[model samples]
Structure formats: C-alpha cells, structure tokens
Target: MTNNDPKTQYNGIILLTSYLQRVFVAETIYQRVKKGHLGIRYSEAKALLDETYTILPVVEKTKQLSVAQKAQLQLITEKTLALMKGYFKQMPLSFNDKLALVGSSLYGEQMMNNGVIRLGKLFNVEVNKDFHMRTQFYEDRTKMVDFLVNSIHHNEQPDVNLVKPIETWVVDILRQKDYVLADMNKISEMIGF
Candidate 1:
C-alpha cells in the first residue's frame, strides 16, 4: 500500500511502536546483565547487547522504505531513535528503577508479547506471562505522535524527566483499552472497506 493510505499509516504506527518496544527491551536486558541481575557472564551480556545493536540497523534497513516514509510515518523513526539514545545515555542503575519512574511504559500488550517471544527465542528464557500481561495494553497513536514531537524538540540529554510523560501516556492508553478497542471497532464498521 502507498504511504499516504490511512491503513498504511496506521500500520506504520503499529510497526513503529513495535520497534520502540524492542529497543527498550534490548536496553533493559543490557542494563540488567551489566548490573549482575542476569546469570550470563559479562562477556556474554556484552556480546548479546552488541549483537542486538547490530541487528537493529538490519531490522530498520530490511524494509525498503521510501524517502517520505519517516515523514509519512509522522517522524516516528527519528523520534524513536532519539528516545533510545536518550535512554542509553541515562542508563538507570536497574530496570526496576526505570520501571518505577516510567511505570511499565514504552509498549503495549501486543508489542510486549512480541518482544517476549523474540527474547525467548534469542535467549532461551522462559516467557513471563504475568509480566507480559501486566505491561500489555493498546496505545493511542495520536498521543504517541504528540509525545515524540514534544520529546524530540528538547535540547537537553534524555532522562527520566523527559521520558516520564511518554510512560504516563502509555499507562493512560492502556487503562482505556476497552474504550479504544470499541472506538476502533466502530470506525472499522463505519468505513466498511
């Protein structure tokens, strides 16, 4: 589908969210290992994080995107990259510390589910269904776009202060999953395409 198509745009938003979720999870794993939380050796953790870093560009490049793809996607690519960089810069002492500040932010249910599945495949760790359920919920794309726009415009280093609003937005969206789903269903019915 063309970039201008609404369905295509919507799907792009979904994909962007998925990408961000993966980035967050990767960073968290890296920090966890570095902090001696995971059982893996330091070398192994570093190797895994390095591999993950390399794989990310491949994931971005795998899709043959148009020049207007980022623009059409509401600058999500730039914003997400900036967010990741900011998080890495901040580098909280622990994942729980970050979670406490952000409150299960950065991904919805599907994104978390997909991330868990990916992590399980890559690390051979059992999926934590409870953790997945606790974090899973739908996010509103409009708010996401707004958060990106606001966050990217800042000149300072990315930190909990800068990202907290994003987490709050995510939490709020997750809380209204039922209403959002109902609205989506109504819109689909009305479009009837």
Candidate 2:
C-alpha cells in the first residue's frame, strides 16, 4: 500500500469500501443502517472495481484548487484507505471467547446468505489479484442480519416458496419462537468523526 501509485491506491480503496459496505452495511455507525438492504452484488463489485478507480484524473483536478481543498481531499482519501487497518492489529478474543459469543452477541455480519458479499470475500480472486487484501474483520461471520432479505419465505408474502432445509426465520420470529433483529439492526450510534 506504500507504493504511492494512484491506481493501486484506488484499488485498495475500492476493496476496503466494498468490504466495509458488505460487513457493516454502512461505513460508520452514524450512517443509516438499512435493515432490509440486500447488500453488495457480484456485478456491483465488478462495476465498483472498474469505476471511479482512476485516481489520477481526480487527483489532477485538485492541482488548480486551493491548498485547503487539496489538503482536505488528501486527508479524506487517506483516512478512507486506512479505515479498516486499525482493526487489523487488535487482539482478537480467544477461540473460546469467540465460540462463546457466536450465538449471543452481535459479532460479525453474514456474507453469503444476506448479500452478494460472498463475492466480496472472493472479489480479489475473481476480478483482479490487485484488488486488495482481505482483513481480519472478514474471518468469520457470526451474526445474521437483514431479516427480510435473508428470509426464505415470508408469512405475509404468499408468493414466497422455499425448499426444505431452509426454514422461515422471519415467520419463526413473528410467532415468538425465534430471535431476530426485530428490525433492530436499523439502529445506529452516530460515529464521532
């Protein structure tokens, strides 16, 4: 990442942004936590990877701008690129601790079931090897979210037909027989920037 190349840096930014979008469903806690959002898709990943990744022109646009504008842009871009880097160094809870929290806590986000985030995990491999590296935050998806999207069948929506092995989590919660966000993932604490 220290290569100082614009395109390379933009690729990093794209991967980080996509990863964060898939994981938290929002960058900072302050952003709107959309509960039913389907999340990042494979095509979206490819589009994002291919689009706005040309940092050269954008950086060039700042050349004629005031020093303050350039400084601000630089600050924002640098911070965005480094967003998940801090979490990388944190000491992960022990294996036992992680196991204990698996079923009870808001650990990590679901990737495969909720969204095309499964592709986000493998975006680098599928698209470009230069995309970006995966972080520790993506290791295990402990918590499931997005009830309406993750649900196999809806009690209200009669058209929803699902096969065996996949039960209706939404229906389970409605009948008070299971747990859900109750749409609570919509709540977010404002990020202090």
Candidate 3:
C-alpha cells in the first residue's frame, strides 16, 4: 500500500525518455531506434515523441507494464543508459540545462495536467541541437525548461534573461535534496527500467 518508489522511478524514466527523444529524433521510429541503437523504448521513440512526458511531474503513479513488455523495456533501458553515459562522459551537462530539466520536472509533478513549461515557451531561446552534434556538447537544457517560474515582469521575448535564474532555482532545490550528481546511477536505477 505504501508503494512510493514506482512514482519516483517513473519520473526518472520519463526524463530519460524525453532526453532520448531529443537525441534520437528523426523522421520515423525506425530511424530513431537505429540512431539510438535501439536504446529507447520502442513504443515511445517516435518522430512525434511526446515532449510533455519529459517536462511534467508525477501525479498518479504509473500502472505496471505487462510482464513481457517490462522485460523488453529493461533491455532497452540498458542500451539507452549505455548510450547516455557515453554522451555524458564526453562532457557533463551544462549548469543551465540541468536547471531547465529540474524546473520542467517540478512543473509537471504538481499538476494532474501541468502546462507551466508551455507558458515559459513564450519567452524561451532555442537550444541548438546542431551545435550539440557538432561539438558533442549535447546541449538540451533550454529545450526542457518550459515549466515553472516565480514572476515574469516583462512580456517580451526573454532571449537569455530567464536562463540564469533557472540554473539558480535548480541549485536551490538540489541543496535541499539528499543526493548529488554522484548519485545519478541511483536515479537511473530508481526508474526500475
């Protein structure tokens, strides 16, 4: 009855899936799967991957996957994490991108149907995926943090105004957390993928 781990794991899995979708986005699921080395879950690795799943937080806990599907997804997650580790090993996430992801996750977790990030989009600057592939920087934080904010006095395009604040917010949250960056593998495993 006190099954809280699923919700936590589910959130982490959704984050990973969202990140993978960005990395492996292509014209078709087949192409995406190939690009990611079949690392992403087959069902979710579509060209039109759901961005909301990544940005939002947990409300209701996830229903259990069918036994067969669970096994398949576990293998997929292993592959996916392997690929992710390789990229992360090249150059760790920029502080800004980490903020975006944390903000997005916070926004999603509060609502049964959250859309804070959508509002943030009105003021966001795009993260350059092309630059990521070229430099292997894997720049993806701005793409995630459409979620939440405290106040927005201006009503114009923000360029990079909100960028630094987001990073600050994330650190504020992390300071309150029990874990740090070294616990990343635990976060991934908590997904139970």
Model 3: per-residue Cα lDDT over 1-193, one tens digit each: 1223544444444544544443343212222212233434333443223433422332222244334544544555555555444332122544434543454334323321112232123225343444234322222332334321212112333346556666676666546433323443553455554
Candidate order, TM-score descending: 3, 1, 2
For every candidate, C-alpha RMSD to the true structure in Å:
16.7, 14.5, 13.9
Model 2 ranges with Cα > 4 A deviation: 26-193
Separately for all candidates shown, the number of backbone clashes (residues 3 or more apart, or on different chains) is 2, 0, 6
Model 3 regions lying over 4 Å from their true place: 1-6, 25-62, 89-184, 191-193
- Pull out the clashing pairs in model 3: 56-108, 57-108, 57-109, 97-141, 117-146, 117-147
Highest-scoring model, TM-score: 3
State which candidate has the highest lDDT.
1
The residue pairs in collision within model 1 are 109-136, 109-137
TM-score of 2: 0.25
Question: For candidate 1, lDDT tens digit of each residue in 76-102?
Answer: 444454444433223433433444223
lDDT of 3: 0.38
Q: What lDDT would each prediction earn against the true structure?
A: 0.42, 0.30, 0.38
TM match of model 3 to true structure: 0.33
TM-score of each: 0.26, 0.25, 0.33
Better of 1 and 3 by TM-score: 3
Candidate 3: residue 90 Cα off by (Å)? 5.0
